[model samples]
Target chain A: MALHFDPADLAARRQAACAAVAARGLDALLVFRQESLYYLTGFDTFGYVYFQVLVLRADGRMTLLTRAPDLRQAHRTSVIEDVRVWTDADGATPEAALRDILAEHGLADGRLGVEWHAYGLTAAVGQRLAAALEGVAVLEDASDLVSRLRLVKSPAEIAYTRRAAHLADDALDAALTEIRPGAFEGDILAAMHGAIYRGGGDDPANEFVIGSGPDALLCRYHSGRRHLDAQDQLTLEWAGVYRHYHAAMMRTIPVGRALPGHREMLDVTAEAMAACLDAMRPGNTCGDVFAAHARVIDAAGRRAGRLNACGYAMGTTFAPNWMDWPMLYAGNPVVLESGMVFFLHMILYDDDAGLAMCPGQSALVTDAGGESLSRHPVTLTVAV
Target chain B: MALHFDPADLAARRQAACAAVAARGLDALLVFRQESLYYLTGFDTFGYVYFQVLVLRADGRMTLLTRAPDLRQAHRTSVIEDVRVWTDADGATPEAALRDILAEHGLADGRLGVEWHAYGLTAAVGQRLAAALEGVAVLEDASDLVSRLRLVKSPAEIAYTRRAAHLADDALDAALTEIRPGAFEGDILAAMHGAIYRGGGDDPANEFVIGSGPDALLCRYHSGRRHLDAQDQLTLEWAGVYRHYHAAMMRTIPVGRALPGHREMLDVTAEAMAACLDAMRPGNTCGDVFAAHARVIDAAGRRAGRLNACGYAMGTTFAPNWMDWPMLYAGNPVVLESGMVFFLHMILYDDDAGLAMCPGQSALVTDAGGESLSRHPVTLTVAV
Candidate 1:
């Protein structure tokens, strides 16, 4: 078995999870998040898109109920011994199968914690599960129990994150070579992804944000690839992934010449990013970091151009994005810790002026302050 | 604006959706699926990962409620005129915003259709939405209403599918050049993706499945990659995407020398694939196609190796998977129709012998039968 983490580490994680469940007075946890499954048992598969769950009792006893496609996957990639399969038919209700399993494990009438905020647990399936266990058990929304535990990374996870950061820098280096005028955005994107794969990195949890010209003002990824104009702005938000752990970075590069006030906005963004990093002290809250960013941008009189949220936590995540819990927004109460990692982005989009400037990178919170994981310096280099 | 589909095509799709909603006695549809939003308005963004929905009324009026990042995205890429932004606060409940929108549209007490199967609508959010609108509206699970309409491709959609198929073939051509003894799976995957991007294709809905060694027996994408041994089996399942329309293909290649009984299994898989295609004629149910595959595989005494379901219908899809509605499993009653695209995969994995064989391709259903979309033939090639 090619388990990503050491068996001892995984065992420790399972023990901690069991302790958490016991502390919450829950009999078991119905884990529907793929990240939690991978972190606890090393069970890795995209089959979570279907009706799949890992039941972890307070005593650390575990069982996985999944589809036929992941039957072999559970056996090969995970340490869990009890793996159950649910057949697919026209009206296959796997929740019924799960109820039977709960009965077998003497938990039919027990209180269970559920990862209800997970992408794996769609509303339709949740409704079915609720109905199946209506008179049997009490379902509690303990969606962030595992996520809170994962916010503080172990040493091995940090090593993987650092490697991912290196790959992110390498991807940016590759993109710089292909970001000249008249270059196709598709080719630039291909080069960036190819660099990560060649460096033994894995596919990112989400699509990279690549937009040029007026589209550069947008932050999300959209379809359609266009060639760079002689004078254009290109915004890129990409992550390097290794063992499913991600280190993301964002930047908006100018082709040929920078836009009006673009250089000044870049300076303000850099200052704001520095302030956010400085606010990532061990005693500070996530809101402090966002406040720092907002203070700098608002003081610069660029409030109209700034995004409300600066950035978010980053770790091992699956599709549809790499953003983790404890987003850096105003009034968030999450406290910063030494091992916590974050992506701090200062994005400014002047809609009326059709100009954009964003500078961001991943950082690991340390005893002193925040330390950048990436080797790339934050600077606006015009591509000629 | 860079709308992928023509304005007329989008208008027609909206009319069809409105008709479907009215037929179901629904006053409005709360579309949570990203594919539905993209099909209805060409509004493309991964922002659906947040609390975002497109509200379409029976009268053909549409309004989008999304986060700040997609405010520009909806305006630039889609034809939607009304785009509302939701702030990202600590205790923000966008469901309340949705309720207010419904009330303003005079649908407070009206029956509404909800796409409950969407990844964007997590169980937690669904619970919140239900609580927020309790006694104010009636919600119905109309998950497949838009999906059934999207299953059958229009002429314009077919053009994009054909282009995607060409890109899939090109990706395979590139993969073949890198698949040899002692080849790293990462490099081969990079080559395939690079080829697709160079051909002006978009990012696929999910990560490509690539496995060698014993992992080749598994069907789902898992973490960790391996190198091809001197004599190994490599299984690859990938798709080419054009404007979110997918044409997927799967193949299991042999390295250096074929496994024991592998060549015979390949022949059996090919024969079974041919039977499946022939069974996809008009008026035939999806179950009939699966029965044909089962007949051929079981008759060849390879029942132990074959999968329960052969393939699934494919069209415009979003993250998590490219497989659409109406999977080709036993007893499925969905009838085949013209312009419906299906990916027919004949997968065989013999655990006893540790052999794997999968030969698959996308095809469009016609009045006559299924026509293969890919130019690449279903034949096993041994890499020396």
Candidate 2:
């Protein structure tokens, strides 16, 4: 198998997932999220764009129903034994095939947990599944069942995150080295990603968020390339991925001499980041982290420029986003635990000044506090 | 605005969308798909990971409901003047905010179209939306309303695709030039992506499908990297993106001497691809293209080695996938239309032979026939 872990480790993960399913009074769990599937059975593929389902029983049995193309994919990448192929013929219903699998496993009349909040299970697919099993079974929206279980990381997973963090540091170094007054934003991005791949990183979960000038105030990737001016601001938010695990980082760099306001904003952002890190220990709530960030910014008279959340939990994820659940927003009740990965960005954008100062890093939650995975200094760097 | 098109073009697109909404007898259309939202108003951001929606009224008025971070993003990238920000407070319900928007627009007592088949609208979110709008409005599943309109590309969209196709050819050339007997797959991928970015290409919707040696028998990208063997086979399927428009290409390369089976498979793949391209005309159905592919493969006695679908539609799309609507599968009745972009991949994998010969390219459907976008030769390349 193409799995990084041993078969025993994969089995233990599946066992834990089954226990979670049984605790929730679900006889069978329909896993839809690609991250959750990879965590449980090592079933890695982009075939989730098509209709594919992994059914895990309370008795520790698992079955994968997928299209013909993914049959070999599942065989090579996952430990799923009972694989079934769903044809793409006209009037073909993979949902019915799923129903048959449930019937064969004696789970037709039992409660089924479906991942209704996942990327793969759209509303139309959910409606079709409900219509197919209306008279035969009961479906419950257990969307967060597997996600919450995956919030805390294991030692092995943490190792992967640390490696990814190192790669991210290398990527940033490459970007800093390539940045100049006349450098194109696209060229810098290319250098950063090239360093990441050379350092043995996988594909990132989202596009690298890079922009310059006024576009730097906006935190998304646009199409065209722009040449940096003599005194310009470039904002970059990217991740280093290892085995689908992400260690995200963000930085705003000045091309030439730094403006006084820009330097002040950077100092404030660093102070807020420190405060957030201090609050990210075991037994503290996610709200506590946000409160710390807010308190630091408010005390510095930058409350108006602060955002609601300062960070979010991160782990194995798919594209369209790398930010995971249990966001550090106000009054979020999720308690921090040891071995949790979090990305904290103290983003302070002064629209009037037309400048942004966002400095962020990924850290691992420990007994004392959050230990930063990235070793890069938080001080603002000016590219000369 | 950061939009590629002028304000008038955006206005005209919104007018067409409003006409469609009125024709369907809907008071307002809630668009959650990133592609549809981008096509309508040029509001491009990955912030859709949060709850964001574009509400288009039947009377040509539009409002964007998004988070605070994306407010400036909307103003900078889109022509949207009416923007609402949803708070991330403890008990903040964005769906209720959506309900309020509908109520303010007099759409509380009318039929509304919801894109239930989209990536953003998960089942749980849809259920929440239904509960929020219950007893006030009728929520109809009009998922295909906007997607069908996007099937036929505009002249401007096709221009972007053509540019993207040229970049794909350049990327392929870079990949071939870098591939050697001892080179790591990761480094090769880095070179290709670096070339794409340097050539002014955007991030692709899907991860580049790349593998070598035994891994070449598998399709999707895996985590680990492997060194190329002297007689190894490497398969690559990647796309060049420009302004979210994708032009995909695929190839199977031999590291050293080409085996007899490899050469035979490549010949058959090229013949099948030529036939498929010949069948892709404006008046033909998608099934006709599939028939041509099947005819060539079956004549070679390699019918069992082929996949179900040869190609799919392509256009402006976001992550998780680039394959668009109107897939070229057997018995599919989607009529080929002028100004449509299609990616046809002739994939043939023989597990017993431990070999694969996949040759593919993107094309534009014209009144006479399909015009190949990629100028790369279909013949197999040996990188010795």
Candidate 3:
């Protein structure tokens, strides 16, 4: 078995989850999020795109219902002993199978917590699930039950996160060498990913956000790759993943030459990032971190370039993104806690000046303050 | 604009979708699948991970409601003129905003088609949407409407798929050089991805499946990568993505030496793959393709070694996987059509012999037969 966590650690995690379930007055929790499944059982696979669920009872017994492809996968990667497979065929109702599993596990007519917000449970399937279990059980929405527990990292998780941070730094260093004028965005992106993989890192949960020239102002990953001009801006947001734990960083580099607006925006971004990190200490709410960022950026007269959210929590995430719950946006009540990881990015898109500056890095929340996860300094990177 | 399709092509696609909506007796179709959004408007972003939706009316009018980050993105990449941003805030209800948008567009109390099977619509959000729009609109599940249209590729889409096939070939050629004895799976995977990106290919929708040694018997991607021993087997399933169109291929190679069982399994896999591809003509059903694979593998007494499904349709896909609709499985009944692409892999995992062999390639269904997309031949690849 290729379990990522120690058996003892997994047991502790599962016990914690069961405690959470008991506290919520639920007999069992239906695990739908892939992250939650990985956390409790070390079961990992992209097979969650199908209808799969892991039932975790308050008594600590666990059962998994998944497709055939994941039968060997669950056995090999997860510690869960009771694995059930739902045969695939036309008009096959996995929801019915899941209902049967619930009944088999004494969950029928019992109050159960379900991860309703999970990507694994699509709307169509969720509807079917609801219909299949109607009047049989009381299903409560416990979307954040496991995620709240996962916000704080254990020692083993932190160690993997630190390794991911190192790999992120390596990726940036390798990309720096390939970011000179006339460089193709595709080549630089490839170099970054290659560096991570060469360091035994895993594929990130999402595409590395890459855009150049006029596209530099965009923070999202979009199609269409282009070559860097003699004087162009390139924005890149990428993560290094170790055992699915991610350490993300973002930077906008200037090619051949740095314009005056680029330097000004970079300074503003750096200051804002510093303010955000300073406010990321334990006892502070996630809103406080956003306030610090907004204050710095708005005080610098760059409100137009600022975004509504400065950053978000980061951890073991699956496809679609590395962003975890408790996003650092205005008025969010999620409190910062030790061992929490966050990617604090200060993005500035100066549309009027036609310049962009984004400087950001991941940090681990400590009792004292936020500790930098990345070794790269926050400064103007002019790729000459 | 960095639209992947020409304006006329996009307009035609929108028109076809509108026609589908009218045929379904709906006033508008709510597109939650990113593939459908990209197919109609060329607005590409992983932002679909959020509650983003595009409303296409039966009259061909279109509108998008997304988060703030994608404001500029939708404008720059899509032809839709009506892009609405939903502010991010604590207790923010984007579903309410969507309802208001629908009211403003005169869709209130109208029959609306919803893509309930989309990854974009999580169970939680879907429930919220249903509640918010209750009695406001009659929502119908129209998940397969757009997908059915996407099954047949346009000339432009086929061109991109052809380029992706070339990239897949390049990736395999690069990996072959790095798959010798003592090679790390990470290094080989990196080489394959680097080759694709260096050739200007986009990221695959999911992680490229790479496994060696005992793991070669498994088909899905799993954590914990290992190195190849002096005499070992490696299985890889990867795709080349160009402008979001994918052409996937799979191969299992032997390192240093090929065992007798490996050669035997390879022959069985190759013969099954050939039979499957031959059954992929325009008039044949997807079930027929699977039947061909089953006949070849079962006749060789490899029933225990073969999987229930042989292959699946391949095309524009997002995170989680490249497998599209109309999976080649038993009793699928979906008929093959010209211009539809499919990835056919014949896998044989012999636990008794501790050997595995899988060889597959993407093909475009034609009037005469299935045309191979990959240039690589199916054979036993031994890296010495």
Give the number of the best model, judged by DockQ.
1
lDDT for each residue of candidate 1 in B1-384, tens digit (9 for 90 to 100): 779988999999999999999999999999999989999989888998899998899999888999988999999999999988889987898989998899989999999999999998999989998899899999999999999999899999999999999999999999999999899888998899999888878889888988889988888777777788998889999999988899999999999988668899999999999998899888999999999999999899888733578999888888876888889999899999999999999999888888899988999999878999999888878888
Candidate 3 docking class: medium
CAPRI grade, predicted model 2: medium
TM-score result, candidate 1: 0.99
lDDT of 3 by residue, B261-323 (tens): 989988888888888778889888999999999998889988873356788888889886678
Provide DockQ values for all models, in the order shown.
Answer: 0.78, 0.70, 0.76
C-alpha lDDT (0 to 100) for residue B187 of candidate 2: 88
* Better candidate number, 1 or 3, judged by lDDT: 1
lDDT of 2 at A251: 95
lDDT of each: 0.90, 0.87, 0.90
Window of ten residues with lowest summed lDDT in model 1 chain A: A301-310
DockQ of 3: 0.76
Residue lDDT tens for model 2, A241-271: 8888999999999888789989999989999
- Model 1 chain B worst lDDT window (10 residues): B301-310
The estimated TM-scores of all candidates read 0.99, 0.98, 0.99
lDDT of 1 at B334: 94
Looking at candidate 3 chain B, the ten consecutive residues that score lowest on lDDT are: B304-313
